[model samples]
Target: MADNHLGEFLRARRAALRPDEVGMVAYGVRRVAGLRREEVAVLAGVNADYYARLEQGRERRPSAQVLDALGRALRLDADAQAHLHRLAGTAPALPLGHTTDRVSPALRRLLDGHPGSPAYVVNRTLDVLAANALAETLHSPFEELDNLARMTFLDPAGRLFYTRWNWTAQAVVGHLREAAGHDPDSPRLGELVRTLSAHSADFTRLWNTHTVRGKTQEAKHFLHPDVGPLTLTYLALDVRDSPGQQLVVYQADPTGPDAEALTLLGALTRSAAL
Candidate 1:
C-alpha cells in the first residue's frame, strides 16, 4: 500500500502537468505516462537512483531539505507538501495503531464539563471512542457507530457535513493512511485499509497519494439538524495518561450564533441531567 501510494502520488503530480507547463518540452516519443524517473530527479536536484528508491518506498526517511526541493520541483500545494514531509518521516508525530487507556472518570468528567464544546476521543483508527452532548448534537451523523474515515467516505450525511467535503474527505483518508505507516503491524488498521479500499474510490485515490498531515488547524463545517451548517476550528489534544490517545475539541467563533448555540446546548444537557 505504501509503495502504491508513493508511486501513484508521483505519477499523478507528473501527469497533472503538461511538460511545457514545467518548461520540459515533449522532446521525443515518450513511452510511459508523466515524467520519467530521471526527469523528476533532475527537477528535484537528486540522483535518479535516490529518487527511484524514494518512489519505490526503499527510502523511508528523507531530509527536510530534500523534501522541500521535491515539493518545489513538483509545485506541491501546502497540503501536498505536508504530505510529502510525512512520507519522508519528517513530521513530529505520535505512534499510530496504539489505542490505549481507559477514559478515566476524571477524563470523562472533563469532557462532560466542557458541555458547550464538541469534544471526543479518537482511537488510532479514528473511531469515535466517546463523545459529549455537544459533539453528539453537532456531529449528528457521527453519533452512529462508525469510524471517522468510514463516516467521512461512506455516509452521505457525513459527507454532506463538510463545505469542502472533497478536500476534507481526502485529508481524513490520508490521515488514516499515515496511521498505517506509523504502525504497519496493526490488524485493525489493516482491516480498515482493506474496508476503505473496497468501499470508497475517493478514499482509494487519496490513500494512494501518500499524503500525511499533522494536527494543524482544521476548521470543520457541519450541517447540524437544528442550528444548520456550522464552521468550527478543531484541536487534537493528547491525553496525559495515554500517550497517543487524543482528545479532540471543537470551538466556534466567539460572537457567532454557533457560540450561542453551544451555550444553549450545554444548558439543555444540564437540564436533561437535572
Candidate 2:
C-alpha cells in the first residue's frame, strides 16, 4: 500500500474532479482521468512543475495561501478541505497521550437516559468502548461487534444487518482513514488496519483510496432479524474532554414503523436483561 498519505490523498482528490465540473471546456479525446496535473496547476495559480512535485511527495510544507487555492481548484467540501490542510501539515497534530478510550461517568449517564434511541461510544479506532442496552440489541447480529470496521468487513452477518452494505462499508473505511491521519502512531488503529488488510480484500481496496471523512449525521438502513427493516438517522457527537471518543445516537421518525419496531426491541432487550 502507498504510505505517502499526503501524496495519495492529493492524487485521489485530483482524480475525482473533472474539467467540466470546474468550468473548463473538455477537448476531444482526453486521455487522462479527471483534470490533468497541468490543468490543476493552472487553476490553482501555481507552476505545473511545483504542483507535480507536491503530488510526487518531493515538495512538502505548502503555504496557507497555496493550500486555499488548491482547495478551491479541487472543489473540495468543508470536510475535504480540512483533510487537505491536515495532509499538507498545516493543521496542528495532537500530541501523543492526549487521546483516551475511557468514557466519563457523566457521558455514561447521558447514554443511559436515551432509552428511546440506540446510543453508543466509539474511540478513534471505532472500538465500542461503551454502549447502552438498546445499542447492544441493535447490533446483536454480529458475533463480535466490538469494532465497527471489523463488523462491517469481517463479519458474515454484516451484509444481512446493513441494508446499505456498500455505503456502510465505505463510511467505516473513510472514518478510519481520517482517524489514522489524525493519529498515525495509534497502536490499536495500526493493529486493526493490519488485520483487516490481511483478511479482507474489500477493506484493502477501500483503504488504498485515501479517503478521509468523519461521521456527523447520516441516514442508516438496518435489517434487524428481530425487528425487520429500519430507517434511522444517526448523529455522532464528539465527547468533550475525550479526544478520541464519540457519542453516537440513532433515532427514527416518531410516527414511523421503525419507531414502533425500536420500542418493541427496547422492551424485549429490557425484559431479557431482567
What tens-digit string does per-residue lDDT give for candidate 2 at 3-112? 56677777888888888899998777767578888889999999999999889988888997998999899887777777888777798867767888888999999999
lDDT of each: 0.73, 0.87
- TM-score for each candidate, following the candidate numbering: 0.77, 0.92
**Scored by Cα lDDT, where does model 1 land?**
0.73
**Runs off by more than 4 Å, candidate 1:** 1-23, 29-33, 57-72, 75-101, 142-146, 267-274
Global CA lDDT computed for model 2: 0.87
128: Cα error in model 2, Å: 1.1
How many clashing residue pairs appear in each of the predictions shown?
1, 0
Model 1 clashing-pair count: 1
Highest TM-score scorer: 2
The collision pairs in model 1 are: 83-212
Clashing pairs in 2: none
